[model samples]
Target: MNGMSRIVKKVTQLLVSIIFMYGVYIVTHGHLTPGGGFAGGAIIVGAFALIILAYGSDALKLHKEEAGSSASESLSILMVLILAVIGFFVGGMVFFNNYLPTGVVGELISAGTVPLYNIFIGMEVAAALLTIFIALVIFKEESK
Candidate 1:
């Protein structure tokens, strides 16, 4: 009742998984391709936004989403920072140094620590954006 038409909701249900998967692909293959963590994160959030728009805020557990996204954002940023700090003690004694072994060029695992960074960055960006969106939704409801 609060959301859009049934057709739109159905379409969203069908497309959400595909969109989410595409975003994950972009994040994972970022080092090999042009799209990276930031782009992928935006795409991932777009999927969630589409769902919310199609189903309305009442259909989803908004408070849980807010809490989860906030926690995810915090944890991901902490992991990223930890990875950076580890470089000082591990490889080159410099921040963000790649300590992991590199693989063959053009391979999926060739980027060493770069992929890890991308994954965490994608998580952080997605969670942060989701949290912002949730806050905006809450504010809008409160204002009304």
Candidate 2:
């Protein structure tokens, strides 16, 4: 697939960073805000989608032999599970327990494990969606 016109590429270049930044903001502030990991991840994926739309699948630069997105998704899932398991040993608690100190309310660092979990979840979701998007793009190209 070929990329769009120069104008589309320029517009996408201008907007992608802003969209990505908003996704990061949503992920980081999930504990105190309405939008959480899933929403933030979707937003990040949308940013990448915008790039793909403007520049085509080749813009991703993903090699055929490497499964980078899947690996990232797996690693993030493992990290989240490890964090949960650590809570069991450290606090003598069950799964999904919050062991870290909860600081002042309405603060960035107040939610302890919640923010950590959200970050991991965001990474996992973003990677998963990107992988799917790339796979679909590849399939579409191959079927032609």
Highest lDDT: which candidate? 1
lDDT of 1 by residue, 65-86 (tens): 8999999999999999999999
> For residues 61-140, what per-residue lDDT tens digits would candidate 2 score against the true structure?
75551298889999999999999999888876688889999999999998779999999999999999998988887788
Candidate 2 Cα lDDT to native? 0.90
Question: Which stretches in model 2 have alpha-carbon errors above 4 Å?
Answer: 64-66
The alpha-carbon RMSD values of the candidates against the true structure, listed in the order shown, are 0.8, 1.6
Error of 2 at 88 (Å): 0.9
Rate residue 115 of model 1 by lDDT.
92
Whole-model lDDT per candidate: 0.93, 0.90
TM-score of 2: 0.94
